[model samples]
Target: MATFVIVGAGLAGAKAAQTLREEGFDGEVVLIGAEEERPYERPPLSKGYLQGRSEREKIFVHPPYWYADQEIDLRLGVTVTGIALDAHEVALDDGSRMSYDKLLITTGASPRTLPGQAYTLRTVADSEALKAGFAAGGRVVIIGAGWIGLESAAAAREAGCEVTVVEPAPTPLHRVLGPELGEVFAHVHRRHGVDLRLGVSAEEVEADGVRLGTGERLPADLVVAGVGAAPNVNLAREAGLEVGDGILTDAALRTSHPDVYAAGDVAESYHPLYGRRLRVEHWANALNGGPAAARSMLGQEVVYDRVPYFYTDQFDLGMEFSGDTRGYDQVVIRGEELEFIAYWLREGRVIAGMNVNVWDVVDDIQRLIRSGGPLPPQD
Candidate 1:
């Protein structure tokens, strides 16, 4: 019997297993995870789950019984010690070998550790620890003002904790949103009573607080580091797979090895739309990439060219961004920060857009990006 083995039962892996069955592939499906708990949604771990608006079990991707009900051979708390590509087998840490006709690696990414009392937001346990740290409304000095850092700051402030956000850039998310739009977000945090510190990094992370490069030492009860994450590509690198920033994959999410594939944060798959390789570590990518790769495994020709999209919720601000914002020559704002639509124009063509507190226009935003049409003249 042909067996399809998927390592790392994160959102991507779990969805791929489900997709395999949905696509009429009746072969054996094995899903493995290093974490003992069942696969769960990660976005809520920092937002709703951390804010007490959601339950721990509510964030799971599927019910505990769903795996068995779907006839998936789910292996929790199992580690893949090695992969024998020639033999088409994966050696487990428990000294067991699983044969595979096709394999998918969705190992995902881990948070980049800084030399500080930092906490990451990738897992349920991590969220719980963050919440416990803010239990007494303690002073929180969080490094990195990216999505994770800002979101954690929001949750911390909601829990009545004093939060001081430190970022090296002039504004938050400067690399992604650029300075103008980034200023919009900076104001949001400042309006919410968060101590916004910009253009400086931590000189030292001590038990009491973080010493800044600007000769200021902020007292902190809990120092959370919401720095960015690096793709977990060590396994693929060790297996001699082609890796650049992340596991290199073709348009169909197939790795260099013929029988092995990669997806999610770990897979820097080719994007036909952008004509470049991208590794998007967002919920939407994992939600869509899994099924796309599953179809490819079943010998279906696919491009896997969905426009990159992601959303973030901080306090009252809800925003959805589409397309890549790099190298845009023009940026037009339709309204002010609170409720507005920002467009990134590359030579008059609308290449990227973000709608803040504007409801139900993501489809329209995507259409604009796909059309590559010039934005209409605005005063």
Candidate 2:
């Protein structure tokens, strides 16, 4: 039996191993991760799980028993230090080497760090520590107003902590939802008693507080940083794979080497629909990309063209966004305030849609984007 090895045992890697078995591949499967914990999803690390609304076990992709039952060699707390593409082997930190007939890299990404002392949420431990800080219910100074920062602010506020968010942008999520919708988010946070200091940079982060570019110092009991994340592409780059913003792959998820494949946030795969390569670092991407790559690895025809999707919950607001919003010229609002659907259009074609406090229209939104149709007025 051929041995299939998966590196970085995240949600994508675990799902890939499961897919290999489900597709009737009677091969030796190995899942290796640098984290001692089993495969788990990351969303909860900043959402429900961080808010103390979700149990620890719920964050796991699979129970511990599942791996044993599936006869997979799940190696945790082990790092793949190097990948020797020519030899078809990976060098582990423990001084062990493993050979593979086929290899999949799902190494994922790491949270970007700030210049000084601050916490970031990327793993379970990170969440737990943040959760404890929130539970302490003191003052919190968040260094970004992006998704993670805003969500952490909400959690901190819920825990009765005095919260303040500092962002260099004119409004929260300015680059993402743009100015119009970004203002809406700003309104919500401000309404919920958050001190949102917009258009100012966090010049310095100390253990006690944050200093702004405006020369104002905001004291804090705890600091949380949510700048963004960068894909873990060192292994692929060192192995001589074609890497750009991430490991470059085709629509089939095949990397520069035929015997090696990539998926999830680490893989910048060609998107047939958008006519460009995209690296979507969202739960939906990993949830679906893994299985797609597995099928492709089994010599099945595959085109990974799923629409980008993500959801967020903060305070009493819940929102879902779908499709690509890049290069949109217009944003159309269908409803009013919090319970509305917003559409991003290029010329006359719908490119993306977001429903805030609205219900059950993601399918319609995605269909409209895929159709690239002109908005039919009067509905």
Candidate 3:
């Protein structure tokens, strides 16, 4: 029987393992992970999990017994130290070696750290720590005005704590949502009593507060760093696989090395829809990429192509988005009030859409994209 070894027990690793079994692969599958806990959803770590509204059990992607029943050897708390490609074996930190006929690297990205007094929200432990700190109730200073920082600020506000978000950019989410939507986000945050600071950089951070570029120190009880993330490509690089911003792969998710594959946040695959190499760090990507990679590995010759989609729920708002926003020509708005939808157009077609508390038309918008129809003019 072929032995398949997969590293990192995150969404990508778990989903890939499940796919292997579902495809009737009667091989010995071993999954290695650095984290002690079972695979859980990471998106919730910054939102519902941080708000204390979600239980630990509710966050698990699958039950604990699921792996055993599927005949998957899940080695939790085991870290991979090295790989010998010539022998097709992986060395573990615990001084054990495992040989594999095929290998999959799904090691996900880690949160970018700050120089001083910085907290991140990438893991469940990180969220637990942040939650405990928020329960104390005081001024919190957050660096970076990206989605993670904004979501953390919203959670802090719900806990009745004063929050201040600092970003060097001219506006929040300007690069991703463009100026108009960025401005709307800034307004919404300010209306919620959040001190949104834009075009200001944090020169230094201390336990007591944060120092701005203007040499002004803002008092803070807790400081969180949500600048962004860097792909975990060290292993792939060490194995002599082509690595750029991430592991470079083809449309079928095969790495430069034959008999080796990668997927999820760690794999930078060719995106047919975007016409370029892209790395996505969303939950949907991990879930979708895993099965696609597995099928490719099984010689099914399937090309991984899907419209990028993700969602975020915060402060009674349900936000859903699809497609890339890099080259959108215009944005069309539908409906009125707080509940509405926004469609981003590119080359006279609906490239992306976002709905905020207006899910009634989500199906319609998806159908329009499937039909390749032009988005309505912005009014």
lDDT of 1 by residue, 93-127 (tens): 99999899999999999998878567778888999
For model 1, the stretches where C-alpha displacement exceeds 4 angstroms are 376-379
Worst 10 residues of 2 by lDDT: 370-379
TM-score for model 1? Answer: 0.98
**Best first by lDDT, ranked:** 2, 1, 3
lDDT of 2 by residue, 30-135 (tens): 9999999999999998899988889999999999899999999999999999999999999999898999999999999999999888998899999999999999
TM-score of each: 0.98, 0.98, 0.96
- Leading candidate by lDDT: 2
**Top-scoring candidate (TM-score):** 2
lDDT of 3 by residue, 1-379 (tens): 8999888899988999999999989999998989999888898899888999889899887899999999999999999988788899999998988899888889999989989888999998999999999999999999998889989998999898999999998888877788867776787788888998899999999879999998989999999999999999998899888999999999999899877889999999998766799888899989989888877878898778777778876676678887778888888877665678888888788877888887766676666666666645752
Assess the local accuracy of residue 261 in candidate 2 as a C-alpha lDDT between 0 and 100. 97
lDDT of 1 at 205: 87
Better of 1 and 3 by lDDT: 1
Which stretches in model 2 have alpha-carbon errors above 4 Å?
Answer: 376-379
